[model samples]
Target: MVDIIGHLGMGLIWLAIVSWLAYDGKTALGFVALGAPFSLLPDIDLWLSKAFQTVNHHGVVHTIVFVAAASIVIGAILAKWVVPRFDGDYLVPPAGSSYVYAIGAVFVGGLSHLFADMLSAPDIAPQVEPFWPFVETKIVTVDVFYYNDPVVNWGLFLSGLALAGVIWWQADDDDSAVAA
Candidate 1:
């Protein structure tokens, strides 16, 4: 499963979660949606260094330490600062800061991304800094599955496309009836 495919599946799940939050909790849909994509951004580190590559992966970025630090730093910035600035004073009161939800949502997205990567990663994507400050044992494994499996990814992509088509078709029918 490529990172993109895993994130796509995760994105579908995230979309459902956000939509439910929007419909049921009266929460800001934008905040809930924020976390879904951020989850995939950490992999960008691969483009930075060949030293990061492993037998089955480009290391460093895929490790738990990396995931944790990234989720917190990025999540905080987006939740506490970027979102508020982006919205200006448009936030509904009492929610005070949409940052709360944004951070929480990003946490969920990051966690989901980690889990997805762990499941399909070719080997245990090496943990270069296993314990960061505590232990430095490099971990390895033989989990042959790619983080993004084309079969599953394409299946999901196609399914999502089909679902979108159905949704649009139904919406068009409704509009036609209304116009009539």
Candidate 2:
């Protein structure tokens, strides 16, 4: 239910923290290629349902099982294939730490999308069944703000930009230290 701006912002914020913690001094900007898109992935159902009618707005893709499965698959691909394939292709390839960063980045990005939709105020329905196929229990129905609200959407987006700036500044310092 969260707008694209808010969802993307949440992903960027998590990408910053995950990269910084997992790969010290890494620039969060580098993760946007992988993370930003995944952050909007859960909403794919919106488009699909419009076409085929099999999916729902807040449906199967919102579940913990779906998120966990995606994380595991993405992690495996990063750890086993993509990282290895890309190694030595770049200016020295990305650091080995990138493999680890990518796994966390994609997972966090995708999960953030679900989190936003869960907490967002629905247009009509009261709640979404995140555990749809398994439990049919609707949760996190707390309405923080209407999805179209400018403050929440723009605020999250701007906040992400500020945090990204901080990450870039820190990374420059780290690079300088390494050079020294």
Candidate 3:
């Protein structure tokens, strides 16, 4: 599986892109806080593997089931409380679309973790069972790089940082334009 930083980069990058498109830098930044952890949530299997010695690192939590449940719970909270209370003047996404995106972000975060793992070494962590329970097979197995490859991980992190920088810069420009 990818390391913490790599997963975080992917999650935050996803949020940044969404925020840039659908909201703004401020909003995306807030979502980044939420999205980063959700990205690593799938790795909870690591603790489970070590503690119980039953489920493996890339086992149950990597599947669609866990993502679905977590997304529903988290999305509901975002819809019910967080989005409504935000003090922004820009139009909030319609409740249904925002609800879907709120849930989708969490789900995508988890899926990003899985895809990152899939992109790298399969032998180290074994392939993840993304469609477990029903399919019972590892869907991705490729030799992109070592799981802990610093170059790939850091590159991803930097790319995400750059994207966020652009978003911030653009927002600042917009603010200045409005003031003028």
Candidate 4:
């Protein structure tokens, strides 16, 4: 329910943390670049609802199941087709690790979007049922901010960028120290 900027901010923040924990500098940057688009993936339901009566924003598409399935499919495409086209310097997944890395990145991006929506969706949009079938109830929204709150949205976006910059800077310093 948060705006695109908020969702993207959350995605970047989550991916930055994941990248720092699991990857080195260039790889982390690549992961963020590749996965950030998926942060807006759930919102595809907005368009889908226009075409299909059963689909709706903040409905089944917001569930974990949808995220998982979409991740696998998107990851496979990225691993088999997209990544191969890029040079080793770009998104170089560790040897034989492309599939896992791609899928995990996609999942993280999607989950971040879901989490942001869960925090603010009920205030304006429909309640998000993130667990869906397994848990047939809407998760209680935190209501910390409104969907279109500029301060919160911009704050998250800028915070995410700053955090990512810090992580990248740290990684560069580490690489330099090692090279010394």
Candidate number achieving the greatest lDDT relative to the actual structure:
4
Candidate ranking (lDDT, best to worst): 4, 3, 2, 1
Q: Write the per-residue lDDT of candidate 2 for residues 50-145, one digit (tens) a residue.
A: 898777767777676776677777766765755455443221224656556566667888877777777684755346666667777665566777
lDDT of 4 by residue, 68-130 (tens): 999999999898877665446334555557888889889999999999998898786888889
Stretches of candidate 3 off by over 4 Å are 78-98, 178-180
Reference-based TM-score of each model = 0.56, 0.80, 0.79, 0.91
Residue-level lDDT tens digits of model 1 in 1-180? 245865655654654455454422223344434655765755666665556443234355555666666767776777666666545323221245554556566666655555555455544355233233455543533354665467766765465445434434544554468579
> Going through the candidates in order, what is the number of backbone clashes in each?
8, 0, 0, 0
Q: How does model 4 fare in lDDT?
A: 0.84
Those runs of model 2 whose alpha carbons end farther than 4 Å from true positions after fitting are 27-33, 74-100, 124-126, 132-134
Residue clash pairs of candidate 2: none
